[model samples]
Target: MSLTKAQIVENIQNETGLTKIKATDTVETLLEIIKSSLADGENVLVSGFGKFCVKAKQQRKGRNPATGEEMMLDERRVVTFKCSGKLREKIN
Candidate 1:
Protein backbone atom coordinates (compact mmCIF):
# COMPACT_ATOMS: atom_id res chain seq x y z
CA MET A 1 0.00 0.00 0.00
CA SER A 2 1.13 3.52 -0.70
CA LEU A 3 2.00 5.56 2.35
CA THR A 4 -0.24 8.54 2.93
CA LYS A 5 0.51 11.87 4.60
CA ALA A 6 -1.43 10.86 7.68
CA GLN A 7 0.69 7.75 7.97
CA ILE A 8 3.82 9.84 7.75
CA VAL A 9 2.63 12.08 10.55
CA GLU A 10 1.86 9.06 12.68
CA ASN A 11 5.27 7.58 12.05
CA ILE A 12 6.95 10.83 12.92
CA GLN A 13 5.00 11.02 16.12
CA ASN A 14 5.94 7.47 17.04
CA GLU A 15 9.64 7.84 16.27
CA THR A 16 10.11 11.27 17.77
CA GLY A 17 7.64 11.02 20.64
CA LEU A 18 5.96 14.15 19.35
CA THR A 19 2.30 14.88 19.81
CA LYS A 20 0.02 14.36 16.83
CA ILE A 21 -0.50 18.07 16.28
CA LYS A 22 3.22 18.77 16.36
CA ALA A 23 3.99 15.92 14.02
CA THR A 24 1.31 17.04 11.61
CA ASP A 25 2.53 20.60 11.72
CA THR A 26 6.09 19.52 11.09
CA VAL A 27 5.08 17.48 8.08
CA GLU A 28 2.89 20.27 6.76
CA THR A 29 5.62 22.85 7.13
CA LEU A 30 8.19 20.69 5.42
CA LEU A 31 5.80 20.07 2.53
CA GLU A 32 4.97 23.75 2.25
CA ILE A 33 8.66 24.66 2.08
CA ILE A 34 9.28 22.08 -0.60
CA LYS A 35 6.24 23.24 -2.56
CA SER A 36 7.23 26.88 -2.36
CA SER A 37 10.75 26.10 -3.48
CA LEU A 38 9.46 24.15 -6.45
CA ALA A 39 6.95 26.86 -7.25
CA ASP A 40 9.81 29.32 -7.32
CA GLY A 41 11.68 27.11 -9.82
CA GLU A 42 14.31 26.20 -7.29
CA ASN A 43 15.55 22.70 -6.73
CA VAL A 44 15.29 21.16 -3.30
CA LEU A 45 17.92 18.66 -2.21
CA VAL A 46 17.72 16.53 0.89
CA SER A 47 20.79 14.65 1.93
CA GLY A 48 20.36 10.87 1.91
CA PHE A 49 16.89 11.34 0.47
CA GLY A 50 16.61 12.85 -3.00
CA LYS A 51 16.68 15.96 -5.11
CA PHE A 52 13.62 17.65 -6.56
CA CYS A 53 14.20 19.51 -9.79
CA VAL A 54 12.06 21.87 -11.77
CA LYS A 55 12.34 21.42 -15.51
CA ALA A 56 10.81 23.27 -18.38
CA LYS A 57 8.84 21.31 -20.94
CA GLN A 58 8.25 22.37 -24.48
CA GLN A 59 4.77 22.68 -25.92
CA ARG A 60 3.71 19.49 -27.66
CA LYS A 61 0.89 18.04 -29.65
CA GLY A 62 -1.53 15.93 -27.67
CA ARG A 63 -4.76 14.13 -28.38
CA ASN A 64 -8.00 14.42 -26.52
CA PRO A 65 -9.01 10.89 -25.62
CA ALA A 66 -12.73 11.36 -25.65
CA THR A 67 -13.02 13.61 -28.69
CA GLY A 68 -10.09 12.06 -30.55
CA GLU A 69 -9.04 15.59 -31.45
CA GLU A 70 -5.51 16.86 -31.69
CA MET A 71 -4.46 19.72 -29.42
CA MET A 72 -1.36 21.58 -28.51
CA LEU A 73 -0.27 21.34 -24.94
CA ASP A 74 1.20 24.47 -23.44
CA GLU A 75 4.77 24.45 -22.29
CA ARG A 76 5.13 24.26 -18.53
CA ARG A 77 7.56 23.62 -15.74
CA VAL A 78 7.42 20.26 -14.08
CA VAL A 79 8.94 18.86 -10.93
CA THR A 80 11.07 15.74 -11.15
CA PHE A 81 12.72 13.71 -8.44
CA LYS A 82 15.98 11.84 -8.46
CA CYS A 83 16.48 9.71 -5.41
CA SER A 84 19.84 9.61 -3.64
CA GLY A 85 22.11 6.63 -4.10
CA LYS A 86 21.52 5.68 -0.47
CA LEU A 87 17.77 5.67 -0.98
CA ARG A 88 18.08 3.65 -4.19
CA GLU A 89 20.27 1.12 -2.45
CA LYS A 90 17.89 0.82 0.50
CA ILE A 91 14.94 0.28 -1.85
CA ASN A 92 16.78 -2.36 -3.80
Candidate 2:
Protein backbone atom coordinates (compact mmCIF):
# COMPACT_ATOMS: atom_id res chain seq x y z
CA MET A 1 0.00 0.00 0.00
CA SER A 2 1.13 3.48 -0.74
CA LEU A 3 1.71 5.83 2.21
CA THR A 4 -0.11 9.14 2.18
CA LYS A 5 0.96 12.44 3.72
CA ALA A 6 -1.64 12.07 6.42
CA GLN A 7 -0.27 8.68 7.36
CA ILE A 8 3.23 10.04 7.47
CA VAL A 9 2.14 12.87 9.74
CA GLU A 10 0.31 10.45 11.97
CA ASN A 11 3.34 8.22 12.23
CA ILE A 12 5.57 11.14 13.11
CA GLN A 13 3.14 12.35 15.75
CA ASN A 14 2.89 8.90 17.29
CA GLU A 15 6.63 8.42 17.35
CA THR A 16 7.60 11.84 18.64
CA GLY A 17 4.60 12.73 20.79
CA LEU A 18 4.00 15.82 18.74
CA THR A 19 0.58 17.25 18.04
CA LYS A 20 -1.02 16.34 14.72
CA ILE A 21 -0.86 19.89 13.44
CA LYS A 22 2.78 20.26 14.40
CA ALA A 23 3.67 16.94 12.82
CA THR A 24 1.87 17.85 9.65
CA ASP A 25 3.54 21.23 9.47
CA THR A 26 6.96 19.71 10.07
CA VAL A 27 6.48 17.14 7.35
CA GLU A 28 5.27 19.76 4.89
CA THR A 29 8.14 22.09 5.66
CA LEU A 30 10.71 19.32 5.22
CA LEU A 31 9.20 18.28 1.88
CA GLU A 32 9.19 21.88 0.68
CA ILE A 33 12.84 22.26 1.65
CA ILE A 34 13.79 19.12 -0.20
CA LYS A 35 11.87 20.26 -3.27
CA SER A 36 13.54 23.65 -3.20
CA SER A 37 16.98 22.06 -2.95
CA LEU A 38 16.26 19.77 -5.90
CA ALA A 39 14.94 22.69 -7.91
CA ASP A 40 18.21 24.45 -7.21
CA GLY A 41 20.10 21.48 -8.69
CA GLU A 42 21.33 20.27 -5.36
CA ASN A 43 21.43 16.67 -4.23
CA VAL A 44 19.70 15.56 -1.01
CA LEU A 45 21.02 12.57 0.88
CA VAL A 46 19.12 10.86 3.67
CA SER A 47 21.63 8.58 5.31
CA GLY A 48 20.80 4.85 5.18
CA PHE A 49 17.65 5.53 3.10
CA GLY A 50 18.37 7.08 -0.28
CA LYS A 51 19.76 9.96 -2.25
CA PHE A 52 17.69 12.33 -4.38
CA CYS A 53 19.23 14.13 -7.31
CA VAL A 54 18.07 16.17 -10.24
CA LYS A 55 18.96 14.66 -13.60
CA ALA A 56 18.78 16.18 -17.03
CA LYS A 57 16.77 14.23 -19.57
CA GLN A 58 17.77 14.72 -23.16
CA GLN A 59 15.25 15.70 -25.79
CA ARG A 60 14.12 12.74 -27.83
CA LYS A 61 11.63 11.66 -30.44
CA GLY A 62 8.59 9.70 -29.36
CA ARG A 63 5.76 8.21 -31.37
CA ASN A 64 2.10 8.20 -30.56
CA PRO A 65 0.80 4.68 -30.93
CA ALA A 66 -2.80 5.54 -31.79
CA THR A 67 -1.99 8.00 -34.59
CA GLY A 68 1.53 6.85 -35.46
CA GLU A 69 2.62 10.47 -35.29
CA GLU A 70 6.16 11.40 -34.30
CA MET A 71 6.72 14.07 -31.66
CA MET A 72 9.65 15.70 -30.00
CA LEU A 73 9.90 15.18 -26.28
CA ASP A 74 11.43 18.27 -24.71
CA GLU A 75 14.46 18.07 -22.46
CA ARG A 76 13.71 18.55 -18.80
CA ARG A 77 15.09 18.12 -15.31
CA VAL A 78 13.75 15.27 -13.23
CA VAL A 79 14.31 14.10 -9.69
CA THR A 80 15.76 10.63 -9.32
CA PHE A 81 16.05 8.48 -6.24
CA LYS A 82 18.82 6.00 -5.61
CA CYS A 83 18.20 3.69 -2.71
CA SER A 84 21.02 2.97 -0.31
CA GLY A 85 22.48 -0.52 -0.29
CA LYS A 86 21.36 -1.08 3.29
CA LEU A 87 17.77 -0.16 2.41
CA ARG A 88 17.89 -2.37 -0.65
CA GLU A 89 19.00 -5.30 1.43
CA LYS A 90 16.19 -4.76 3.90
CA ILE A 91 13.63 -4.70 1.11
CA ASN A 92 14.96 -7.85 -0.45
Worst 10 residues of 2 by lDDT: 31-40
User: Which candidate leads the pack in lDDT?
Assistant: 1
What candidate 1 gets wrong by more than 4 Å, as runs, is: none
**Which pairs of residues have clashing backbones in candidate 2?**
none
lDDT of each: 0.99, 0.98
Checking candidate 1 for backbone clashes, the offending pairs are none
Worst 10 residues of 1 by lDDT: 33-42
What is the Cα-based TM-score of model 1?
0.96
Task: For residue 90, give model 2's deviation from the true position in Å.
Answer: 1.2
